[model samples]
Target chain A: MHRLALSAVLVLAALSAAADPLPSWKDGPAKQAITGFVTDVTKAGGKDFVPPAQRIAVFDNDGTLWIEQPMYTQLAFVLDRLKVLAPAHPEWTEQQPFKAALEGDLATLGAAGSEGLLQLVIATHSGMTSAEFETIALDWIGAARHPRFQQPYTQLIYQPMLELLEYLRGNGFKTFIVSGGGADFMRPWSETVYGIPPEQVIGSQIAQRFEVRDGVPVIVREPEVAFIDDQAGKPVGIQRHIGRRPILAFGNSDGDIQMLQWTTGAPGPSLGLILHHTDAEREYAYDRESHFGRLDKALALAPENGWVLVSMKDAWSHLFPPTQGSQPDE
Target chain B: MHRLALSAVLVLAALSAAADPLPSWKDGPAKQAITGFVTDVTKAGGKDFVPPAQRIAVFDNDGTLWIEQPMYTQLAFVLDRLKVLAPAHPEWTEQQPFKAALEGDLATLGAAGSEGLLQLVIATHSGMTSAEFETIALDWIGAARHPRFQQPYTQLIYQPMLELLEYLRGNGFKTFIVSGGGADFMRPWSETVYGIPPEQVIGSQIAQRFEVRDGVPVIVREPEVAFIDDQAGKPVGIQRHIGRRPILAFGNSDGDIQMLQWTTGAPGPSLGLILHHTDAEREYAYDRESHFGRLDKALALAPENGWVLVSMKDAWSHLFPPTQGSQPDE
Candidate 1:
C-alpha cells in the first residue's frame, strides 16, 4: 500500500477502536454521565482524578442488572425449591406458607407477610453445605426460564449495564454486586453471566457454620437470618463486605437509596445512578406503586442528591443479550 | 559504544530485573514450595495450571504477617480505649472485666474467660458510625508502638511475607487478608502498610445498621457480635465474604486450619502454608501452649494435609521491614 493510504487506514482503525465504550447505551445524559465520570477520575494530574486502587464501583443485581418483574427470579427459585422438597416434608401440603408456595398461589403467598416469607426462605435455602447449595443454584439457573419472557433469567440482564460493567473495569475500576438477593443464590452464576466473580458479590446471607463431616471441612447454612441487604441495610452491607466506601453505585429502587447516599455523599467526585424502568414495550415499567421494586422515594430524592435516573426507554438501545431458542414457537 | 558492549549491558539489565521475586526468603524448602506451586499453577497448558481469574490467595494478618506476641495489637488498642473511656464510666472502674482491663491486671483479665473478653470487645468496638470507627482505628494504629519492639506495629510486618504478597500479585494472583482481628481495625492501615486494599481484608465483625442521623445516612456499629472469624469460623467467613475457595492459604495458628483445609481440599492445584514462630532472637517464639496464636493441632495435621510449615528462623533472612525510627538510638 502507498504511504498516504496506509496512514489513512491507521487513522481509521484508531478512531474505530476508540468508538463508544457503551454502544448499547443511547447518546444521552445517562451515558454521558458514566463516560464523563470515568474520564475525569482516570485522567492523571486532573482535579477529579482518583487512583486506580480507590476506584470501587458497586451495582445492584435484580432490577438494575436483570429483570425483577413478575416477581424476583430468586423468589421463583424458592417456589420451585418448595415443590422439590414437598415430597420429603409431608406436612408442607397442609401448611399455610408451604401450601401457598407449593400450589403457586401468588395471592396467599403475597399476603403471607415477611414472617411467612422468612419461613419459606429458611425451608428452601438452608440445611445444606454452601457447595451443595451452589450446585443446586447453578443447575436451576441453567434450566429455569422466565414465565413471561420465556427465556432464562440470566438472558434478561440489561445489555447497557453489561457494557457499562466492562467499560468501568477497562478503566481500572473494580466492579462489585451489592444486592438484596441471596449472596449464595447470585454467586453461582454471576461470574458466568456478568463477568463478576463470587468474591466481589455482596448480598444478604443466612447463618453459616464450618464443620468437618466424614473428615471433610464444609460450611453449612443455618436457619437464621444473618443480614438483610435492602433499604438502609444496603450501606451496612457495603461497609461490612467491601470495607471501603464505593466511589460509584448503581441501583433501581428505594432499597438502594441509602447505598447511593453512602457513595455520593463522600467528599470526592463520585457518581450515583438509578435505572428507571420506562420501556414497558421492551420490559416492565411499573416503578412508584410496584409491588416488587418500589422506587418512589429514591426517584424523588435523586435530584437533590445529584443521582441520575437513567430512563430505560431513552437510555438503552437493547433490552437484553440475544439468546438462541428465546423466541416463542409459532 | 560498540554494539556488542550495548547488547551485554541490555542483557545484564534484563537479568537483574528478573532476579529473585522473593529476595528476603532464604534458600529453603519453604521458599522452594512457594515457587514450585506458583510455577505449576501459572504455567499455561500445564497439567496443574490454573486460570488467572481463579488465582486467589488468602493470608492471616495477626501472627502470619505481623507481630502478635506479648499481646495482640488490637488488644493493646482496646486496653488503651479502656483507659481513655474510664473517666466517663466511673462505674467501669468497679466492674469486673472493665476493672481488670483498666488496671492493667493481665492475670485477672485472663481469669475472666470468654464472657469477660466478649464484654471488653463489645464495649470498645461498637456504638459509632463506620467512618468514625475507621478514623479512631487509623489514629490508634499510627500512634501505638509495640512495647517490646519499641516501634510502630505497622513496621513490625514480616519482610518475607510482604515479598510473597508482592510476588503473588505480580503473578496475576489476587491476595486477601483473612484475619481474626476486627475488620474495621485492620482496614484502616492495611492498604498503607501491606499494599493490600481494604476491600480485600476480611475479619470478625460486629452488628451494624444504617440510619439517617441528623439528616445524614450513616452505618452505625451496634454492641453485638455478628460473626467471629476464628477457628471454625475461618472457613465460614471465607465462604461468606470471598465465595470462591482460594487456591492458596497462609496462616500461623489453628484458627486458620479450616481455611487452609477448605482451599487445599478443592479439586485443582492448591497450596497451604503455616508460618512457625521459631526465631526467638528476632521475634518471640511460642506455639502449643501460648495464650495468643496457639498452634498445636494444625502443626500436627500439616504433613497429612500437604501444608508446608514455613520456619520463620530458616525461611526468612530478615524479620521486619526497616523503619526510619526502627534503629537503636546511640
Candidate 2:
C-alpha cells in the first residue's frame, strides 16, 4: 500500500513538471477551463478524449495570433508597399485606395471601409507572379515598422497566444493558423513567427492564373477573390483546406464567431475560446461596437456553448510584445 | 561466442523490423540504395538528416496510387457526368467538346485536344458549388465500374501503394497527393480511397467567387484556370501548397518530372521514385511513349537525380483492391 502511494505521488510530480505555455495567465475559471479540457482529453481513460491521430488544432491568425489593432498587419504591409511603390508609379497619385493610402488620412480611409481595404489589397497584390508577391511581402515586412508601435510588424505578435501555440503542440496537438489574410502573405512569415508551416496555415485567397510568362509557367496573381476566409467564410476555409473540424478554435472577435461555432459544434473533445478585450491600460480594449476585432456574438456564445472567455484584463500579466524595451510605447 | 551470435541476429531482426515501407522492393543496387539512405537518416548519428517534423512525403495520385490505364478515372467520371447531364443541357450538343463526347468517338474527342478538353471540363465543372461537385463525384465513383477490367473505380487502386501509404505514415511521414485532377473531385473521395484527407490532396483547381447567392454567400465555381497540378506545374503546386520542398516524391509519368527533380534536389535526406509500368498481363506496360501517363524525361532523370525506379511487375504480389480478391489470374 505504501509503495502504490509512493508511485502515485511520483506520477503527480511528473505531471506537475510538465510545462504550461501561458505562464502569466491567471488561474481563474478561464485558465482552469483551458487546462482542464487539455488534461482530460490528453489523459488516459478520459471520456471526451481523442487519440494523437486526431490531435489537430486550428487558430485564426489576425486578431488571435497577433495584434490587429489599428489595422491588419498584412494591410499595413501593403500600405507600406504602396508608399514604396508610389514613387515608381507616379500615376497612382489619382488612384482611389492607393491615393488614400498615399495621403495617410485615417478618417477618409476608414470611411472607405471594406471596399477601400479590398481595393488596396488587390492593387498591391496583383500584376505579379506568386514568387514576386512572396519577395515583396518579405521585403516590406522586414523593413517596415508598425505606425503605432514603431517596431517591425512581425514583432507585434501576441505573447500569450504564442505560448499557447507552443503549449498545445507540446501536448501532442498539431497547431495551424487559419486566417482571413492572404494565404501567400501569411505562408512566408508564419513559420518564423508561429512555428506553423505554410501547409498548416489556411487563409483567404485570390484567383491565380497559370500561364507561360517569359518562358516560365507561373501562378500569377489575379484581382478576383478566390475565397474570402472571414466570418461565415471561416467554416468554408476550414472545410476546404483543413478538412477536419479542429478540436480547439481560438479567436478574439466577431469575425471568428463562425469558426468558434463550427469547432464547438463538432462532436468530440473540443473548445471554442474567445479572447475578450477587457484591458485598455496594458493593451487596447474594445468590443461590441468596436470597428476592429469586436467580441460581441462570441461573448454571448461563451455561457451557452461552455466556451472559455479569456479576459485580457484579468488573465494576462502583460500584453503587446513582452520583449522588454523592444516595442515602442503606444 | 553463442550469446554474441544470438545478440547479432537479434540486432539484424530489429533493423529489418524498422525498415518496412519498401520491404517487397527488390533487394538490388536500387533497393540497397533506398534502405542505406533511409537507415543513415533515421538512425541517430546521421548528419543532414531530418527529424519527424520534416518528414513530408508527397505522391502523384492518378497512376502512382491507382490504375489510370483505360483513362484518367477522373476523366471517365467527367465523361459519365457529360452523359448524365446531357439530357438536361441539350444546348451542349451545340458545344464543341460536349458535342464530341456525346458522339462517343474518343479519337475525334481527343483530337480537339486541350481546348476541347478544357471546354468540356469547364462546362461540366463550373457554375455549380464545390459541395455539388463532391456529391456528383461520390455518386459516380460509388456506382461506376471500369470497363475491360470490370471493377469499381475505387477498386482499381493498387494494394501495394495503399500498404506503402500506411507504412510511411506509421513511420512519421505526412503523405500528400499532388495531382492534376480537380481538387473538389479528388478531395471528396481521397480520404476513403488513399487514407489521405482532403487537406493533404493538392490538385488542378478552377477559380471561385465568394458571393451572397440567394442571401447566402456561396463559393461558386468559375470557368477560369487556377493552378494546374501537372508537368512543370507540379513543382509550383509543391511550392505554393507545401512551403517546404518535399523530401520524397512519387509518380508514374513524365508529368511528375519537375516534382521528382524538385524533391531530389532538396538539400537533405530525400527520395524520388517513379512507378514504371512493366506488367503486361495484369496491367499495361508503356513508358517512353503513351497517350496519357508517358514517362520518358522522368525515366532519364532517375539515375542522374538518384531517384529509385520502382517496376510495378516485380514490386508487389497484388495490384487493385483487396476486396476484389488478390488472385492475379482468372
Candidate 3:
C-alpha cells in the first residue's frame, strides 16, 4: 500500500480502538446496555448524567469477575491452609469440620453447614499477624492453578469482565469488589490483577486486634467473624464502607440478589447486571442447580426487576485473556 | 508603572501564591517537619520517596481536625437526642444514665463510665434506617453550635489542618479520617467539611441490618455495638478498611497513641504528628487533665517516638476557618 493509504488505515484503526472500549464484548444487548447506561450517566448536562463522585459501581468477585467454578478460590485457600497447618493442630485431625476438611470430604463438609465452614475458616485464617496472612495468600495466588483451565487462578479471570471494569473506570466510575470472600485474601492481589486497590474492595472480615509485639506494632487476625458481605450483607457492606448507593452493580448468583435490588432500586437512573454463565464450552454453565453460585431466585427475578441478564456465551467474544504456552478456548 | 513591570509583578505574586500551600501554618518546627516529610516522600528518585499509591495519611477527626472541647459533638448530639426521645420513653426520665444525660449531669454520667456512654450512643444512634440516621445526624450537625466558639460544629475545624489536608492531597497523598466518632454520624458531612469522602472515614460503628421494607431496601441501624475505632481500635480499623498501614498519622489524644505507633512503626519513612491544644485564647487548652481528648500518654511519648508535637498556639496562625457571623479569635 502507498504511505498515505497506510496512514489513513492506521488512523481508522485508532479511531475504532478509541470508539470501542470493550473490544472483547460482542455487539449485543448486553454491550449496548452497558455502553448506553455509561453514556447516559456520563454525558455532561444530560438528564441522566451522574456526577463522577456519585458514579460508584460495585462488582461481586467470585462468579462475576473470575471463575468460581469448582469452588471459590478462598475456600480452596482455606482447604490448602488446613492441610498446611494440620500437623500443628493435632486436635484438627479429630474435630468434625477439620476432619472433614482434612479427608477432602465435601459431602460431610457441606453437611456441616455454615457453622462448619466458619470453623474451618477461623481455624485456617486466624491466629497470625495480618502481614503473615497476606504473604500466605499472595504465595497461594501466585502458585495456585485453576483445575479446569490449568492456568493461574488470576489468569482465569474473565477477559470481558476485565474490559468492563476498565471501561467503567475510564468513564469515571469507581469500581469496587463487594465480595463474600475474605477481604484479607483478596487485598493482596486485587490491586495487581483487577487494578482495584485494597481500600476499594469490601468483603467478609475476621476480627483483628493491634498489638505491639517486640516493640513493633502488628495487627493480629483473631479467630472470629466480624462481618459477612454476601446476599443481604452486600448492601450493608456497601453502606458501611462506601456510604453511598452504587449506581451500578454486577453479580452472578442468588448471593447477589439483594445487591442488585439495592442498586437498581435507587431513586436515580441505575443499572443492575446479572452475569448468566451460559457458555459451558468456554466456562462452567451450571447456574440454577449449581451448589456454588446458584442463580435460582436472581435469574427468576431479573426480567421483572429490569436487570440486564448478560449471556456470556453470546456477549463475550473471548473468555480468558491470551496466555503463553496455552491455546485459546476453542 | 510600565506594563512590563506590572506583568513581572503579577508573575511574582502568582508564583508566591503557588509556593505557599499551607499559609495558615506559621513558619515553625511543626510546619517545617510536615513540609520536610512530604517533600522527602514525594520527591522522585529520593531514598525516602514513596510511590503515590503508598502515600496514605490518616487524620483523627474530633480534636485533631475540629473542636472536641465543651464535650464531644457526638456526646452533645446524644444529650440533645435524649431530650427529644424522652417523651416517648417516660422510663428514661427515671433511668440513671438517661436521667443524667437529660439533666446534663456530667459527674453522674462520668461515674457511669463507658457502659453508660455506650448505652447513650446505642439509644440515640440506632433504631432507624441508615438514611434516617444520616438525615438526623446531618440536621444536628447543621444546627448544633460549639458553646465556646459560638459557630456551627463544622466551621470549628482547624484552618491549618484543612490546609495541611489539601497540601497532602496536592502532593499525591490519600487522606483518611480515622476517628472515634460514629462512621454514620461523620459520613453525612465529612466530605463537605473536610473534603474527606465517607468511604475514607473509618470510625466506630453500631450493628446494622439490611432489610427490604415495603419492597424498598434499607440498612436499619441496630442497637448494638459493632466496632469501636478508638485507641488500639484505630490500627485495626485501618487494616480492616484501608488494608494498608498509613505512612502519616495525626491525632491529639491518648486515644490516638496506638494509631501513631502503627503508622510510624511501619518499615518505611513515616511521620506521626500529635496536635497539642495549647491555644487557651484561641481555643480550649486543658490537655492532660481534660475530660475529652485528654493528651497524656501520647504527650509523654511524642519525643521518644519521634512524633512531631504540633503546638496549636505556636504553629497555627489561625484556628477556625472564617465564619459569616463570627469574629476571628483575637
* Candidate No. with top TM-score: 3
Q: After TM-score superposition, what is the CA distance of residue A126 in candidate 1 from its true location, in Å? A: 1.2
lDDT of 2 by residue, A197-244 (tens): 888888887776655555344667889776688887787677656555
As a whole number from 0 to 100, the lDDT of residue B132 in candidate 1 is 92
lDDT of 3 by residue, A1-330 (tens): 454554454455447767788877889999999999999999999999999989999999999999998998889988999999998889987889899999999999999999999998998899999999999999999988877778889998887888899989999999999999999999999999999999999999999999999999999999999998999999999998999899999999999999999999889999999999988777889888998899999989999999999998889876775541343453
- Give the CA lDDT, 0 to 100, for residue A158 in model 1: 85
Local error of candidate 3 at residue A35 (angstroms): 0.9
Candidate 3 deviant stretches above 4 angstroms = A1-15, A323-330, B1-16, B324-330
Candidate with the larger TM-score of 1 and 3: 3
Q: Any runs in candidate 1 off by more than 4 Å, and if so which? A: A1-17, A323-330, B1-17, B324-330
lDDT of 1 by residue, A1-330 (tens): 454554454456336535877866878999999999999999999999999988999999989999999898899999999889999999988999999999989899989988899899999899999989999999999999988888889998987888899999999999999999999999888888999999899998999988888988788999999889887888888889888889999999999999999999888999999999988877888889998888999999999999999999899866676442232211
lDDT of 2 by residue, B209-302 (tens): 5445553435567887766788877876776577666787889898987787667765567888888889887887888878778889888867
Docking class of 1: medium
TM-score of chain A of each: 0.93, 0.88, 0.94
- Candidate 1 lDDT tens digits, B117-197: 889999999988889989989988889988988788899898788889989999999999999999899988888888988
Residue range B95-206, candidate 3, lDDT tens digits: 9899999999999999999999999999999999988998999999889888876788898888789889999999999999999999989998999899998889999999
